[model samples]
Target: MNKEISIQLSNVSKTFRTSSKSFSTLRDRLINFYKKNEVKTIKALKEINLEIHAGETIGVIGRNGSGKSTLTKIMSGTFIPDRGGQVIKNGTSLLLNLGVGFSHELTARENIYVNGSTLGLRISEIDELFYEILEFSELEDFKDTKIKYFSSGMIQRLSFSIAIFAKADIIFLDEVFAVGDNKFRKKATEALKQNWLKNRTSIIVSHSTGVIKEHCDRTILLHKGELIFFGETEKALAMYEELE
Candidate 1:
């Protein structure tokens, strides 16, 4: 696994500050002093150490708010670690959470260009993958429509479509295969298979053990910010299932 490390994290930790009260009104920010409860910080991750080699498909699984997305952001270098060091060797594309990197005012087609560019893909590259992305999303009917009018599933379908075709060296996905109808999911499955078969590295965040069991050769577990397990998929999955 350490043959050629694409990413490395050493004792990384991230903490977020929390306010005592939700600031709903301007007056709250203006005069909220003693009315606020004790301010505390949440440790999203602590002492996380991991090494990702090229051509590895690793599955990241944990319950909701188990610091999964936080870890992904940390790994992608979008969110800086407060206490440790990380090195990433290649360009990485990520789908961190729902509703990221899309413009509400733009048409789906325009946003496709925008999102693709944000992922560092050239217009020519996107063009080559354009029809394929559309075909995968099954949203050709809504391609010219504004994204504000798109349903959640539609947004996810298009986002996933663009992400897969962006052509970064490393791909990161969150809760994939949950968008679109069965047909699109089936198509996406094939695309993912092809990507892995080609030796492109990927880290997939999913709730379904089946995704890990079927696609990933390795599994990494994080519980409340610690690296609890890292090993073969079946053994890690077995330990995770026992946590319930």
Candidate 2:
């Protein structure tokens, strides 16, 4: 427990119990369930020991399915670790997956208020930021259109815009995969640099080595749910390349 640590994981291990039956049939489940129901525990995090300090941009990078999202969930308090524990010392909002809250029937404008407030914005705050979100999303013309008419890229762009509107001590972003076009992606990236990078504890999980090299001060490498390296960005990236 370092004094400056905003997030800490000490020997933290997270496991999930899954059943073989898939809840299909009682007979099949009972027949095959003689072996104690065949419950399998999947370890999503293994003996993770790390610390995140204030005003640090840390990148959590690894291949797909390397438990990056799981780790984000734990930090967001959406999932509790099974064995050893984790602690978050600041307010954290995770934009790990996009489109988790937008209703298809609702207009993009409506979703802004609903979704933005869900991220902890006050109604007045959302009202003040509505135009900004629409502007940043590049969806002004589509503001009245239902989200069902929006493309995946548009949805992500909108979600990203909304996620950063409300102030938080810490934020976790899971890749910039669906930010419309390259131009829009660059816009979002610059917004992140100009806005989120200042006076915030941010964790970004990205596959882009260039992004890690360019932005992160510290990097952590994960392989098959196990933490392999935690140190300076360059050193951890070297480990990532060797593992790859």
Candidate 3:
């Protein structure tokens, strides 16, 4: 049987504008009246074309500001590409970035519902997975505690637990392993391999070559918002290493 396409990016590109002026007050603005409010346009992602197959694990590696996160956001539908570009998504997708789509003022229990809904899960479905999420996060006692009071590690644990149960067709992981303690990291890694990533289509962004080599079947390298390579993991890593 042939694998179905899970994601397709056709001539996709993203651009962002930043203003050089920092005029906070009328006086500040008047003082800079003679100077043009210079705005710089940055191409976060240059025309890119790619296809991801169902159940494929892809690793995206790049230097800071190389468009790794930008690409992930575009694929997850959190960011829109420029005009003339099209992003085709065949199934449900989720982007797992730290503290994204979670309410800080709400308790962990409440946030679970928020995140579950955001991931396209019905309330009844989330209810069935609530205890499992709590057990995996090891935060059963802190479920009632507001997210603002939780430490970064604790927050990550909760987020990861919720994601594993999200049951999305495609998942985007952005530096997920960087959070939490060593022990928790090990647990998370095990859970990811044994449960979350099993037969799931996923795109992972990380600086760690070991992670890419271990989990990804193929790797994509980006440099200065341009796609440089997309092929076997070994060759992609070699190309990425040459830039350092």
Compose the digit string of candidate 3's lDDT tens values, residues 1-244.
2379989999999999887756656887898888878789999999999988898999999999999999999999989999999999998888998667778999999999999888888999999999999998999999999999999888888998888777788999999977678888888888887765678898999999999999998899999999999989999999999999
Ranking by TM-score: 3, 2, 1
Q: TM-score for model 1?
A: 0.88
Better of 1 and 3 by TM-score: 3
- Candidate 1 lDDT over 1-244, as tens digits, reads 4478777778788898776664556777677654765568998887888888888888898766678888888887788888555545555655535557898999988988999888788999888878888878888888899999998888988888787666677777777767678887888778767864257778888999988888887888878877789878998898889877
Q: Which parts of model 3 have CA positions greater than 4 angstroms off?
A: 20-37
Q: Candidate 3 overall Cα lDDT vs. reference?
A: 0.90
Error of 3 at 179 (Å): 3.4
Off by over 4 Å in 2: 1-3, 22-35
Lowest summed lDDT window (length 10), candidate 3: 19-28
Quick one: RMSD of model 3?
2.4
TM-score of 3: 0.90
Candidate 2 lDDT by residue in tens digits, 95-180: 54666778989999899988887778899988888888999988889999999998888898898888767667778877764466
